[model samples]
Structures are given as structure tokens and as C-alpha cells.
Target: MKKMMQRDSTWAGIFLLPNLICFLLFVLIPIVSAFVLSFMQWDMLSTPKFIGFDNYIRLFTQDEIFIQVLVNTLIFTACSVPMVIIASLLIAMALNQQILGKKFYRVLIFLPVISSNVVVSVMWKWLLVPDYGFVNYFLSWFGIAGPNWLTDANWSMFSIIFVFVWKNIGYYMLIFLAGLQGIPNSYYEAVEMDGGNAWHKFRNITIPLLSPTTFFVTVMVVIGSFQVFDIVMLMTEGGPGRSTSVMVHYLYQQAFRYFDMGYATAISYILFIIVLILTFLQFRFNKSENWSS
Candidate 1:
């Protein structure tokens, strides 16, 4: 028995070794290296010089653009997260009904989730082109002139937020759909016997049961919002004068464009910390809710 157990353990270890090595090399090592790089001034070519806390100090105290980018990130997250959650939930509920061609509708909605971000951004860029774009053209028919979505500073951030929500809502909707399906129909029947309306059933049963899925979607959306880069880069390039400059985009510019690898790494760490804190808070809130319930 002992010999057989040892053989089983050996085979398990052999199967897991490749994945463990990849995780260490790709994820763990890079994370450690980035943390080390955050404290030193290295431009990718020169030998790293110890900068102590200068990078962090400058980012907080002197970098005016960093402050703007931070605010932009917060605004993006705040606007997009709630919208995504609400939209996804509503869509999921709608699709959960016994409607015609429900599967087809789900497939169409989820298509964008699988589409490449670069392609989505580029497509939206063309769609939102000031005068010639389909969006503005459609608005023109209603005699309402559309604002420059990607060009105007005031509208650029909102445009990106809109695109972000539209592109990613499908993913969250699928999650919510699964949550909705997992809920037993007995709850609804019980509510019906109690003379509960749709609103009461949703408020009393669906929302509570779906809290776990909501929490998961909220955390993911918040993290993705903070790391928003590809769409911003492809659509606006952090422009109409830095209106859409997000943390990741700014980090990319610092590291790749300006060649300030250390500063970029520091920015990356700040992003990591911010995301970690937010995610922790979400979990804490979920725990408290569970206890209260």
C-alpha cells in the first residue's frame, strides 16, 4: 500500500511540475523583479541606480499628470462598474425568460466578449468619428448634432467608459445568467404562492441569492477598469490632450515611450496596491453581508 501511494504521488508531482515551473517563471519571477525595479532608476539600457523613494515621492508630490490619471482611473471605475453590473443583471434577467431565439440572442450579446479589444476599439473609433461616423449620422437624422466623442476632452472619458461597458457587459451577463440558472425555481413558486409580484420576488429572492455573483462581477470590473489600456490606446491614445490617460496607459508611456522603466514599475505597483485594496474591501463587504444575512 505504501509503495503504491508513493508511485501515485510521484506521478502527480510529474504532472504538476511543468505548470509550477511556468507559474514561477512567468508570474512569480516577473512580480518580484517588478517590485525590485520599482526602487531603482533603470531606463532598460543603463545599470539600475538606487533611487530609494524618489519615484514614489515624485509620483505623489510633483507629478501633476499622475494626479489627473489617478482621478481619471477612479472616475472610470466608478462609472463603469455600477453600469456594467446593472446592465448585465438586467440583460441576464431578460434573457433568462422563455423568449424566442433566446440562445441566438445570448450568442449575439456574448460575441463582443470574445472579440479582440483592439478590434473593438478600432471599430468603435470608426463608429464615433465626428461627422462621418454612423453614431453621429444617426443623431443627425434626429436633428441633434452629436458631440465629438473621441476628440472632445469632456466627452472622451465618457466615450471610453461607454465602449468599455458595451464591450464587456456580455462577459458579466454570462456570469449572471449562470447565477440565475443555478437558482432553483421552487423559490419563485413559493413567492408566487405568497402573492408576491415580480418586483417582490426579485428584491427578496433573486438579489439575495445572486449576491455572490454580483460580488465577483464587481471585483472583476473594478480591476479591469483600473487596468484599462488597450481600448484607450487604440481609440484615443490618451488624448484630446490627456483626457483619457489612464494608469496603465501612463505606465506604458513611462516604460516604453519615455524609457523610465523604474518609474513605470512604481506606477504598476501603485496600481497593484490600489486594486488589492479595492478587492479586499469587496471581499470584506461580502463577508459582512453574508454574516448579516
Candidate 2:
């Protein structure tokens, strides 16, 4: 029996080898290399020189732009995540209500999520133009002056946040809709037996049952928000005056534009740390739910 088990294990290892090789070559090797590279100073033209913690030390203490980029990234994520979650939740609930043309509405909303971010950003850049754009043109009727949505220092982040939220709502809404459907009809029936109204049903029954879906959406949205770059590049280029520069964009600038490989790797690790902390916090909250169950 022991020899047979060993034979089976060997065959299993043989079958897994291809996938393991691919993982090592593509994912694991790059990650390990990046970790090592973070401690070395290098330009594309020169040999890498070991610099220890100098790169990280400069990122925290000596780099003003890095600090600004961190702040901008945090603010953008903070503003965008909740807005996307709430908006998507509301839209999902409405769409799930057996309304007319529900399929059409779902497709329309989801189109933006599937569309190219570059194309959307370019189109919106025109629509958000200070004078001739359709947005400001419409605001003219209300006697309210619409600031340059993409170009103004004060409004650049807000404009991008609004567009980002709009673009993501459809995708997240589908996830929420699936969750809403998973909720058994029996739960609502039980609530009705107790004379629970809509608010009570949502507060006590919907929220608790939907917490798992919320957790999933939060994690995905947070990860995507942290990596926001393409839209910023296409729309504002981290201007007017770096008002819209997120962390990933700054990393791109450092690594590609400035050819500062060590500093870029340091910033990437900082992002990794931030993401790790947030993920841990989410799991901590999730564990409470598990314990209660």
C-alpha cells in the first residue's frame, strides 16, 4: 500500500509539473526578481549597483512627489471605492426588481465596463472640455459655471473619480445582482411573516446575507483603484500640476519616464505593503462573520 501510494504521488507530481514550471517562470521569478531589484540602483544603460535601503529611505523622507502621489492615490481610492460600491448596489437592487427592459438596462450599463479605458478617457476628455464640452455646455443653463473638468487643479481628481465610478458601477452591479439573486426567497417570506417592512428587510436580512458579496466587491475595487493609471494618463497626464497623479502613475513615471528602477521598485513595494494591510483588515472583519456563523 505504501509503494502504491508513492507511485500515485509521483504521477501527480508529474502531471503538475507543467503548471508549476509556468508559474515559476512567469509569476514567481518576476516577483522574486523585483524584490531583489528594489534594493539596487540601476538605469537601463548601467549595471545595477547594490544600494541597500537607500531607495526606500529616500521614498519616505526625501521624496516630495512620492508623498504627494501617495496622498493622491489614497484620496482617489477613498472617494471612488465607496461611491462605486453604493452606486452599484443600488443599481443592482433596482435591476433585480423585475422591472421592464431589465436586460437592456444591464447591457447598457455593462458596456462601459467592457469598453477600452483609453477610448473612454479620450472621449470623455472631449466631453469635459472647459468651454465646448457637452457637460459644461449643459451646466450653462443652470447659471452655474462648470470648471475645466480635466484641466483645473481643483476639479481634476473629482472629474476622474466621477468617470471611474461611472465606468465601474456596471461591472460591480452585475456581481451584486448575482448576490441578490442568491438570497433565498424563503428569507423574505420569513421577514414578511414578522411584518417586516422594506427597510427592516434590507437592514436585517439583506445586509447580513450580502456581506460576503460586499467583501468580494470591496477587495476587487480596492485592488483596481490602487492600480488606476491608464485613464489618468489618457485624460489628465497627472495634471493640472500633478493634482491627479496616483501612485501607479508615479511608479510608471519613475521606472519608464525617468529610468529610476530602484526608486520605482521601492514605490511598488510601498503599494504592495498598503494593499497587504488593507487585505488583512478585510480578512479580520470577515473572520468575525465566520465566528458568528
Query: Which candidate comes out best when scored by TM-score?
Result: 1
Per-residue lDDT of model 2, residues 100-187, tens digit only: 9999999999999999999889989999998899999999999988998888889999999999998999999999999999999899
* lDDT values, one for every candidate: 0.96, 0.94
Candidate 1, position 41, lDDT: 98
- Per-residue lDDT of 195-279 in model 1, one digit per residue for the tens? 9999989999999999999999999999999999999999999998989999999999999999999999999999999999999
Q: Which residue pairs in candidate 2 collide?
A: none
Model 2: residues >4 Å from true position, as ranges? 1-15
Q: Give per-model TM-scores.
A: 0.98, 0.94
Deviation of model 1 at 53, angstroms? 1.1
Residue 96 miss distance in model 1 (angstroms): 0.5
Model 1 stretches with alpha carbons more than 4 Å out? none
Candidate 2 — what's its lDDT?
0.94
